[model samples]
Each structure stands twice: as structure tokens, then as C-alpha cells.
Target: MSADKLYILDTNVLLHDPNCLYEFKEQDVAIPMTVLEELDSIKDRKQSVAQEARHVIRAIDNILSAATSPTQITKGVQILVPGTGDDSKLGKLSVFPDHELTSRQGFLPIEKNNDNRIINCALHLQSSDPHRDIILVTKDINMRLKAMGAGLQKVEDYRKDQLVSDVELLPSGHYHIEGNFWEKVSDVKSYQEGPNTYHKVSPDLLPEAYVNQYVFDDSNDFAARVESIDHEKTVLRDLGFGHLMQQSCWGISPINIYQAFAMQSVLDEDIDLCVLNGAAGSGKTLVALACALEMVIEEGRYNKIIVTRSTPPVAEDIGFLPGTEEEKMTPWLSSIHDNLEAMHENDDRPQSSVKYAIEKANIQFKSLNFIRGRSIQDAVVLIDEAQNLTPQQLKTILTRCGKGSKMICLGNLAQIDSNYLTPLTSGLTYIVERFKGFDGAANIHFEGIFRSRLAEYAEEHL
Candidate 1:
């Protein structure tokens, strides 16, 4: 095993992942005094960041109490997992006080700012231990740049929560086969149900397929759907959704196979969680909303539809917003109203029939602030703009689902508005990779733009 390395953690890294303390196996971690002060400033807020701050503080306190006395925290205290019995890799955690840095020679100016103090701490540690490797781990780009400018060689981002390094390499949940696809599958055990045919094949003999994933063969115009997979068998179902895709749902029809797969996922009762990722003008929102209404209003599947999003500002400040909760959220939810209005353009009732249906169907628009500590049941929960959510926030939202409920998360990973989040570590990509082969979960990536030719051209050209 390699020798343990010293890692100086930034405040943002801890807030990004509360369990980051134990993630560095067999390595020493140091927390700057300024970081604790920063945590104290925001730990009382009512958002996810505040919650994470509290979690980190609790973890640090527990570690200190379990180890040597509290007065010895500065000298260095060994941190061990409570019950893991793995002491060979147990690392030390310590807080570098301001006096330690200020007493050192050639130390940078310890300004009142937190970022500069943190950098100075790292610099002091590097100068003290010339034989050991000390790296500064942070999520802030500007902090990294400043550290590099201060002669720190080993600076990096916390990569524990990132699932995919490249967005293009993410799984598409669909595969295409050529040259006699049906003939290749005829030798497998097969049966037919009400509307779909089922086949069981071996995972080693065929391409990898997840439950509810789409498979198309353009050579013979054949498409298959994955039903289930187990150790002994891989169950496949025929694509019986072609005719259903042609049917109108709330005045919207499938424009492409991407939309068709999305519709099949949302309308299927067997799939409880559906995740959709795509760019603007790909009909992601419109398709999900259409199927949601059909299930809630027409088929009597779900009793209500609850809509919520990250509430990240697009081009305006949220501080100046005025009115009731619903009124403040109306602008953020304008796409929902616009899609509903377009669906009801040919209605014979008044122009406000969309509003009437929303009230009659028991659809409610909610803000993401209060999603915690509530159990949602018998409803279709829609989380739009999921790319702006952190992984911790996403976990809290998904845990709110109760019995007889479905959740649909839609987002464009390329348009993340969160300052501390990236495309690789956003909630949308995290859920997509985590739930790939899990039962009752399915994900689809839409690349087709059905809004208009100009929009499609812009998507491709601009």
C-alpha cells in the first residue's frame, strides 16, 4: 500500500458531501479554522447547504469525542470508523489554527477573507512538510486558481460524487441492432402476453439491457423492450407501443422515437421512477406532462399531479419577487402553463379551460424549499430542472415518495445553473447512472427536437 497523503479540505467540499471525511481512505485530512467559521455563518439557514453544514459539523464533533481529549485537537487526532476494525488505514484529522500559519515565516498575508486564509494554511503545511505530499481539495474553481498562483502544485476537485467524467459517454438506455435481429432472438425461450411478446435470453449472449430500456433493429424494423433480468434469465418484451404512440394524449402525439420511449415510460404503471435528459426544444417537458395528465385525468391512475423545480433563477433575481407562494412560483412554472395552453388550443370552452382542468385534476405547483419532511402518496411528482439539484438534495426528494405514487425527473444537464454543481456531478446524471439496472426505474435521453425547424436548426448549429 502507498503511504498516506495529506489532504487539506475546503469548506465547499465538505458541504458538497458530508461523508467526505471518511471517503479519503488511509489519508490524513486537515480542516482550516476559517472553514469552521464559514460553516457557523451558514449552518442555520433553511436550505440544503445549511443541512449539509450541520452534518459535517456533527461528524467532526463525533470524531473528536471518540478519539483523544478535546484539548489535543490541535496536536492531531486519529479518526477511525466507528465499527470498521480497519486501523491500518485509519487517518488523522486536525484543525490548523490561525496562530500556526501566522507564526510561520514566508506565509502569505492572512487577510479577513476566508479563501485567502485557507490558501495560506495550505501553503504553511506544504512548507512545513517538504518531504510529504499535501494537496488542496476544493470545489471552487477560483480557489484552485488562487492556490496555483500561490505555488501549490497539487490542487484538485473532490471527485467522490462524480459518476461520469464525460457527458457523451453516459448510457442512452437504448441500443440498435442490425442484420436479422428477430432471427437471432428466435432461438431463445419465448411467450406472448396480452399486448406484448416476451423472450428470455442470456446476458452473456446478447447486448446489455436494463429493465424497460428500448432496443431497435433498423435492418428488419424490429424493436424489443427489456422486461426484467435476473441471474438465470433476461426477459425481453416486444415493442407493443407503436399503436399506442400514435394515439393522442391530451392533444399531443409522439413526434419521434425519443418521445415514444418517454411516453411509454411515463404511462407504464410498472415503472415507478422515470428520468429524462435532453436539451431545450426536445419535447421532454411536453411529453412528460401529456402522459401525466392522461394517467391522472383519463385513466384514473394517480389522484393528483405535484410539480416542483430547483427554483434557480434564469436571468432575474429572486429577491425582488412579490406575491403569494403560487404567484412567486408562477413565472418559474410558465412552461407548464404554456404547454397546457397549447394542448387546449382547439377546445370549445373558454380560453381559460387549461386552468379549469388543472384545478379539477387536483394538480398543485409547489416550491422545492418544503419538499423535505413530507410524504407524498397517490400522486405523480414532477421535478423539472433537476440538473440544478445537488446529489444530496436529490436523495431527499426521491425519499419522499409513498405508496401508489410515481416520480418523473426531467432536466438538461448542459444548462446547470447551480454554482457548486457540474454536469458530471449533477443530480440528473447521478440518478441516471445509479438506477441504470435497478428494477422499477428507467431512464431515457432525448436528442430529437420537435418544437420547430428553426429550433432544431438552432440546436444543431448554435
Candidate 2:
């Protein structure tokens, strides 16, 4: 089909995904001059988004370099599909110089505010080009509302990285059968392999099953992990429900069945990545920390435990803090300490035991800023508050994992703090959906709140 629409991207969209320019298929894309200026101002900051801003600038430059003259550049430049020749069908990319326009004409005034100028640019394009559809794409909700209010033809949130329409549709990492799970299975070949039991059933038995996903029944009689699936059959590794509930790590046991699944994944050496999603007080941090300690301190499977998380104010406030990087991060990582304290509360000397565990595990608290270029190996990396991260930021961290390393990502989608991220676009959700089919990864969305009655009540009502 011929390209009939023009997409004007905002600054936040580029920062959210640097490679979004190529996702529009055959639609023409444009960047307002104000958006470029915003990216220029933010490219030098210490925040993770600054790196993405620089990438977007470089991508735009690479595409515009194909143009021979300034007129052709401002008008449009062909965006060829990567690895394709010049004859390949492609879309056009251009820079809209909204700063040169003097006519406001019923649009938002081009004041000192950059958002107003960008909205006015889209409004101008809508009126100037009556033949094509003009759409304003932004991650900012207020900016979209202003563009629509300014009489623009169309305004939409940047959804190129959004995999699901609603957060409710996300996989909970486990499927619960209404009654006895075995009763639903008609054709099944059960066998034993070494110490593990495996069941080969028809694909129609669990059509929605994915590798590494857990399945159980309400009767509490059966629990199994999907090991492999193909056109012929689906293989399941039977996990006795009672045994899973009885599993303990670092003197900590699962409080609920969902946590049992999470503990199993986190403690398993075969799984390289484990993603834990839940509400506040759902014991995500506690379970992850406990398993990390078990693997690092008691079992000696890993050399150390590395804990890190992204804070909203980390860009500006982290540099001003006193002492070392660990001390500065202690405030944001206080939740980790809280979990440690809770785990050692019953000990004879709680404070001393917590300090000893910290020292014994060789735990290091690092900032996400310094984790870009280092290769992490022989350690258990725990990333808390992963929902606040963008997909680009998460990719940077995930790629740093070297051989003999495991990553545990913990996040509460409802508590995302980034202004540029929603539940559908959060890095946690992206990884869960992207890695669901991978055999070496496991995802668990915890159930219930175990912190306290007051906390549980607040989580539901307040």
C-alpha cells in the first residue's frame, strides 16, 4: 500500500525507543524542530534517557545524510529498510522547521514552552497538507491532550513498543485449572527420567502453554512446569505441590503457592533469567533476596550478590550524596535492607546477623549508571523496581550478563514512576512477554500481600 499518513514524533517517544523511526512500516515520519532542540538539551545529562537521546540524534543524522541539499532534507529523505538495496520500497523522514512558521492561526501559541511549539507544528501540518493524514505521536498524556485541543486532526500515544492492549492481558506466568488437572488430560504418556518425572501430552491439552510456565490445579494435587512444546506433544516436568511449598531458601519458605513458583525459578540453576511481578507487600523483594542469599552465601553457587535499582531522582540527586556509591544507593535500596532485616528478625541478634549476612554474601550495591560497560559474571544480579525502566535501559542491563550469571527482575507494574512509561511499555512487561517462550527464563506474578494487614488493606482500598 502507498504511504498516506504522516507521523510527527515527540521528544519522549524517541527517548523511550531510539529505533522507533523504522517501526512505522510505510508511513512517513517527521520530527519537529522543537523535539530536536529538546533532545540536544537532554543529550548531555547523566540520566539513562540521555544515552537514548544521543542514539536518536545519530539515527536521524544517518537517515538525513542521504539528502543532497537542504531543501530535500527539509522536504523528506527516503528511509530504507536496513540491509536492503536502494530499489527497496521505503518511507520518508524529514525535519519540520516549526520555528520558522509565524502564523499561529487558532493553534497553541509558540511561547517559551516547547510542548506548545510542537503542538502548533502538528496543527500547522494538518492545515497545510489537506491530502494526507497528520498524526501527533507522544508518550506524554498532557501533550497529546493539548494537540487534540488545538484542533489537530489526530493524536496518539507512541505504542510501537507496547505488546498488549491492556495490562490485564499480560501472562500471570501460571495457569490454574478449575479442578483436578489430570482429569482434563485425555492422551498423556508419563515417564521417568533420572530423578525427574516427565509427561508427554497432546498440544491441545494446554494450548496456551509456553516453555517455563507453571500450571497447577485448584485441588492442590498437581503442579508442573512446561519444559518443551512442539507440534506433536508438550512435555511437562512434574513438580509436586507439597514439595514446592516445602522448599526453603536461606531459612525462608514460601508463604503462598505463587511464591513457591517464584522460589523454584529463582533457586533453579538452569534458569538464567527470572522475572517477578506483583503488587506492593507481595513479597517479591523478600523472595528474590532470600534466594539470592541462598545461592551466594549458603550454596556457594555464585561469588556475590549485586543489587541495584533505578530511582526517579537518581540522575540529579545521586551525585550530591556523600560517601561511596553504595552509601548513596542505600537510601533507595532501603527496601532490600528492610527485607534482610525481616528475614533475620527472629535471630538472637538481628542487627549483627544482618551485617554478617551482608558481609558473608559479599553483597555490592551498584548504581545503574555504572553498569553499562561492565561484564557481570559469577554473581546473582537483583534488579528491583524494574517497572520504572524503559525497554532500552533494560536491554543495556540485560546484555551485561556474562557466563555463569543469573538475573532476577522484580517490579510492580501498578507502581511505575517513570513519566515516559505505562504498564504496557514498561521494561518489566516487555521482558515478561518477550522472554515467555524462552526455555531458560521464568516469569511469576506473585499473589496476595504478606507485609501486614494494614498494608494489605491499603493495597486494595486506598
Candidate 3:
């Protein structure tokens, strides 16, 4: 049997998603020896990426276990898809011994760099099999440019986990109407359910409506949340603009309607997951913290508040810091403290008020490295800087939420810090699009930056 295409895997791609092997349906995948060496070096590190490295190593071993000898491993091993019994749909996996490649006229010098070695392997495969399509798949942009510049035919980024093609096309969680919302509706049914008002209208009125998505009109008269949508009709729960603007939590009120939408979701007990996406200084962290404090301290709905975020790779080895876990995490979590201080800045004694609030709310700062295989119950989990996380990393943290818990993910897509992630591939964007239609999840994208005039100007011009 002849394969149409052959894809060479990169170390970063497997680290980005361990299960990416199954993403290619029928296309054969090859792993260079250099990639395995890179994973071996990273598997012993203390960072969260080390866990992913180990996972990829185990997955590759499991697939190649069926091979009998070194020759068979180099030739190809049939990959069996879990839960599928079809033999025709299997893709072959093989290991390319790139270290044994001799110095050739066209091959890049592989003295010490693993990237050059991987590129040379792809080039050798391309030359050996002229009929098959050879593609180099990686998450590194500079590597792609380098591979293409070194005379490789096709180089592509691994886009299997990218939900949207462009970040600008992501859902904003709210629909805006130019004129009056009621004027566009020809037929509608209005009623009162207990203290809440409901409106049932044609689904055509809001073509892109989703559950829990806010809707407003320019007339400043109508504001509602999409309660339900079906082929027959769409139901909306009327939320008055005046009432939304008047809502406050922990002595903090929203400065705009966008922020009010976010506060509404973070404060709602029915919403199990609330995702806030916006520019920096859009009050994502401040609003979530205020609502979390209100729930834990004022209402006593939750037992405590847990705050965590993915640290940059350079700062992942935080074990050397002196003090307890919370103390070690304080520098990384200073933004949380800043927001707490901002909330209490008006008090006679600001530092004392902040301390009292922290104790009263029972807030705990946690590290993402220690949040695995443990169930967190009766707490509010707030994940800040969510844009720096991959989808797999985000899933690990989200699954830690146990009984009687709510999770709030705050991210700014424009401020992603991960080398392997783009705005489209950030976990923040992934969850926003994936949870838009869920009944228990709400998403809000803040457009205004209320931190200061400098931040607002920097967001626009700089």
C-alpha cells in the first residue's frame, strides 16, 4: 500500500498536544531521533511541560510496542485507533534515524542543533520518496521559516487544535443591534415567569444567538440574555440596562455595559464556568475577584477562593523560592493582591482592610504545577492569564473543579505569552468558542480599558 502523504512530527507539536498522533486520520507520521532526544531532556524538568513530555514519550512507546525489531521500527508500525476495529483506516508510524544521516550537499549541518537535524531528516525523506508528499509540522514560527529557507518544499504549523482561523472572528458573547431590537421583530410573545420577564420571538431576529449570550440595542432600551434557541422560536430573558448598571459586588461596580455583562455572569450561581476575554486593563481580573469575594465573604455561598495561573516557562522552576507555597506564589499572584488593594483603597486603613478581606474570604494562591489528580471542592477557582495556556493545560486545571465549585477564566488574547500558542490557539479562545452554547457557561468580552488613560491609549496606538 502506498501512502499519499508523510508528516514529520516536531517536538513542540507533541508537547502542545500529546494526542496529536490521532489527529491525522490516514496520513502516516514519522518521528525523528532528534525529537525523541529533545523529549528525553525535557521529561525530567519540574515544569508542567515536563508532564506533557512524559505523556508523549509513553504514547509513542505504546504505539511502537508492536514492532518486533529495529528494522521493523524504522520501516513502519501499524497504528491501531482506540475503540475502532477497522484495519483499513490505520496509519503507519515510524522512527527516522536522523542521527545516522551522513553529510550531504543539500542536508543542513547537524553538528549540535536538534532543529537542523530534524530539518535534514525531512529533506532526506523528501529526496528518497519523490512520489509522496513530505510535510514538516511544527508549532515554532522561526523553525518553519528556517526550514523553508533551507530548501524544504512544504512546511506547516500544526493547526489541528486551532478552533478559529482568525482571532478577530471569535465570539464576543454579545450581539449588538443598530436600531431598536423590538422594531426588527414582527411577531413576539412576551410573558412574566415569577419575577423575570421572557420574550419569545423568531429565531431569525438574532441569527447568531447562543445560550447565555447577552443582547442589546443602540436605543439603550432593550437588554436581554438568550435563554433558549430552537427551530420553532428563540427565548430571551429580559435584563434591563438600568438594573444591570446598578448591580455591584464587593463595593465595585462596572464602568460600562460590557463589564456589567461580565459581572452578571461571574455573580450568577447558575453559571458554572465564566470566561472573560478582553484587552489588558479591561477589568477582567478585578471583576472576577470582586465577584468571588462577594460570594465567599458576603453570601457565604462558597467555602473559599482558589487563585492560580500558568507561569511563563522561564519562571516555572519556582521551587527555589523561600517560604511556603502561598508565599512563593505571591510574586506571580501580585495582580490578585493589586486588585484586592484597589477594592479597599477607599477605606481608612487600606492595608488592614485588604488583610481582613483576604482572611475573611479564605483566599488561597495555588500553583498550576500542584493542581493535578486532586479534586477541589466548595471553592471558586479563578484562573488568571489564561491566554498563556494551551488547551490541554487548561483542561487539566478545569477538571480539578469538584462539587459545589465555579470556575472563572480571565484572559487577554492580545497578551498571550506562550511560545507555542497564538491568539487562535490560546486556551482562552478555545474555551470561549467551545462553551458559548453550554447552558451553565457564560462568556463576556470587555471592550473598554478602565485602568487608566495611558493603558487605553497604549491599547489603541501602541
Candidate 4:
């Protein structure tokens, strides 16, 4: 609908995007007291959700603190977007207290149930403001169902940062030319430089080409990647991945074009940010690690490899585990160890070992909790399981990169573990869509499973 409707935001929405309040510009936002309690309970933790909880709480506090009087909150407090020119369209922020909402004619309360309390709060708002359109915004599927069942006319998931509606709609970073592509490119100027061939085509000819996007013409066995895009022309370079596919990195060679593209992205120093999306057995992490090792150990382009991942638990929170930070992160970083051991197999040196190579290459495992407020320079930073991170968390980690540093984000969107994230809203998808056209960024979607035949079968069937 329009931007004048009233929105009741669930806690999960705020955790998914702390800045969601501003997204519903000029729309009245009502925060349930139960949501505040939930945020307060989780704000002291080390997870990204806790950080988001704190940020949202502070933002709401700031908005309310600007109120002229305490009674203004009851009527409604104007939430201003400092630079926006429309004061007449400024949104209103209100709080719905648990005490103010009780078991009514059609609503029943479940004692000590936060979800039930939230739904009840929405029901109260819906009944009170029958003239104004009210909607409940949430990321939880069951919460939306319960809200719908509670007679709320409108309920939906937050979609502010979601560029694509589904994973199937995500950008493929490549386009296939079906016609006589060679004839289409006959008028284009071409030249060869070093290992790459360059072709300058009119921007109109390559409508779907973005910076660093691969383009293929299967009819003539021609493939080229977009090198640069400007208003006047688009320059494409022949991709070397076809030739490099057979070459071994550490001990692993790319089994498919997807893996080769992924390697090209991770090893290219010109590309500052690389996003890899693949399934469990697609060799996303393994290829990333192998490229990181090659860049750090053989090429000496970066000083070290810094790896990190979200530590989202499978079930309930088990509280804090006792150990040093590295020791505590070992459980979450088991995949890194497995990949490193595979890399060690190619080392023919008599004294070479996984421990020795890791030490020699200066590979460091970092916990995502302590990644903020520090600059990571001259390193190959690999963020694994990025699907579990919120877009806000991914932004924080990427901002930490300094000069001479490369950041590679690898994840399978379908395997996200975060309760607040979906395949379309995962941080990996965020990066892919956000940086799709940027010259310093590249994206690779792995389609092949290279681990083993059994692993491929399991990935496909199970």
C-alpha cells in the first residue's frame, strides 16, 4: 500500500535489519513492549543479533527522547529523517505496552509467550485503529501465520534489502548469446594483451553485461568477461579460466567452469570483493582456501589468510563455552581445518604438514564477534558460511578491510542457519546484488559438486 499505513514490527524484523524503522518512510511504526523485552534480554550477547538489538534499541530511544513531553509518546512521536524535505510526511513512532493489551473478544493471551504477546499487541492495534490500515512486519514464518489467524488483515515479511524475490531470480553474472554471436561481434574491434584478449563492443550490443560479468557464445566456442563498462563502450577480455581449469592450485584442480570462475575471482588482485554461492559439496570453501593459500604462500601478494564465519548454533543457546578465543572458535572452524589438510596433501616437502604450512603461510582463524573496529590489511580475508549473517553484519565485516586486502565471502544461500535470514535475504545475496556492477567485485555461482560421487548424490537427493 502507500507509505501512510501503520506497521507493527516484530523483533525478528529488527534483528534482520536494524535500520528497518526508516525503511517504512512516513509510515507509523508501533513497537510492542514484548519486543523491547526480547531485545533487552539479547543485547548483551556477542552475536550479530545482539549488535542489531542494541542498535535498534538506541535508535528508538533517540527518537522518543526527542519528544517534547512524555504524553507525546502516547499520542505519537514524530520520527524525523534529518535530511528529508517532507516534514508533513514524517512518520510517527508509538509503543504498544503489554499491559495496555489484554485478552479481548477475539484475542487470547498465552502467558509468558513472547510470540503470542506480540500477536496480541497487533490484534489490539488492529481493533483500535479500524480506520487506518495496520500491518505486522516479521521474518518468522510461524509468527506471520499466527498473526493472520489472529484476524490481522495485513502481515508480511520485511523485504527492504531483498533485491531478488527468490534464489532462482538471483543474477547469474553471465549471459549466453544464442544467435550468430561471432557475426554480431564482427564489427567490434579486438586486440590481445598478455594472457587476455580484449574486445571493445558498443554498450548497446551487450545490454546485460556488467563489470566483470562473463559472456559466452557456445555456437562459436567464444567466451569473454566484461573488463570495464563506461557510457561510451564496454570492454570485454577473454577469460583465462578455460586454460587455468586444468592447472592445480595446491592439490585441487577446478572440475568445472563454475569452480574456475570462483578461482579466477578469489585469485585476482584487482577484484577486491568476491562472492561465492554454492551448495555443501560444490567446493566453495575448499577452492577459496586453495586460492588464499596460493596468493599468500606462492604469490606473496598478501601477508596472511584471515578466515571467519558466523557461529550460529543449531538448537538452543548452550551459554558460553570455556576457552581462549581461538580455542573457542575451533569448533566453528572445523571446515577450514579439513580444507587445510587437503591443501597439505600436495606438499611434497619431507617436513611439510598442515600445521607447518598453516604456520608458514600465517593463516589465522578469527571469530566474527571481534572483527569490528579493527582494520585488516595486507591479508586474504575469507568469510565462510556467510549465509548465516545479516546484511548489516556482512557490511561490518567488509568495512574492516584495509588497503592491500581482499575479502572473499562464500556461502550456500539454501543452507542459511540464521532464523531471521532467508535464501533471498542472506548476506551473500545482499553482496551479490549490491556489488553486481561494481568493477572491484566479482560473483561466482557454483553449480557442480566436486567433493565425491556419493556426496553429489546426497546433495541432489538428500
Candidate number with greatest TM-score = 3
lDDT over C-alpha atoms for residue 149 of model 2: 77
Candidate 2 — worst ten consecutive residues by lDDT sum?
A: 81-90
* Segments in model 3 whose C-alpha atoms lie over 4 Å from true places: 83-87
Q: Which ten residues in a row have the lowest lDDT in candidate 1?
A: 311-320
Where's the lowest-lDDT run of ten residues in candidate 4?
314-323
Q: Could you give candidate 1's per-residue lDDT for residues 1-462 as a string of tens digits?
A: 323478899999998888898888878888998899999987986455777899899989877775556567865677778667455666878888854566246655765667878888888778878877889999999999989998997999998989888988787877777666766654588887886778888765455767777877665346677888877787888764465457567778988776787887888898889999898889888889988898889889999999988875522333357876666677898888888887888888735789876986787887776677899999999999999988888898999999999999999987888888899988888999999887788898997887789988887898
Candidate 3 positional error at 421, Å: 1.0
Residue 260 of model 4 has an lDDT of 76
The C-alpha RMSD in Å for every predicted model, in order, reads: 2.8, 1.6, 1.3, 2.8
What clash pairs does model 3 have? none
Model 4 TM-score is 0.92
> Candidate 2 has which clashing residue pairs, if any?
none
C-alpha RMSD (angstroms) for model 4: 2.8
Residue 430 CA displacement from its true place in model 1, Å: 0.8
lDDT of 2 at 410: 96
lDDT of 3 by residue, 64-161 (tens): 99899999889888878856745477688899999988657568877788899999999999989999999999999999999999888999999888
lDDT of 2 by residue, 1-462 (tens): 436999999999998899998888878899999899999999999776788899999999989999999998778888977666452556889999989865446666676888988888888888888888999999999888877777887999988788889999999999888989888888899999988999999989899999999999987769999999999999999999999999999899999999999999998889999999999999999999999999998899999999999898987788999999999889999999999999999999999999999999998999998898989999999999999999889999999999999999999999989888999999999999989889899999999998999999999998
- The CA lDDT at 35 in model 3 is 97
Note the Cα lDDT for every prediction shown.
Answer: 0.81, 0.91, 0.91, 0.81
Backbone clashes in each candidate structure, one number apiece?
0, 0, 0, 0
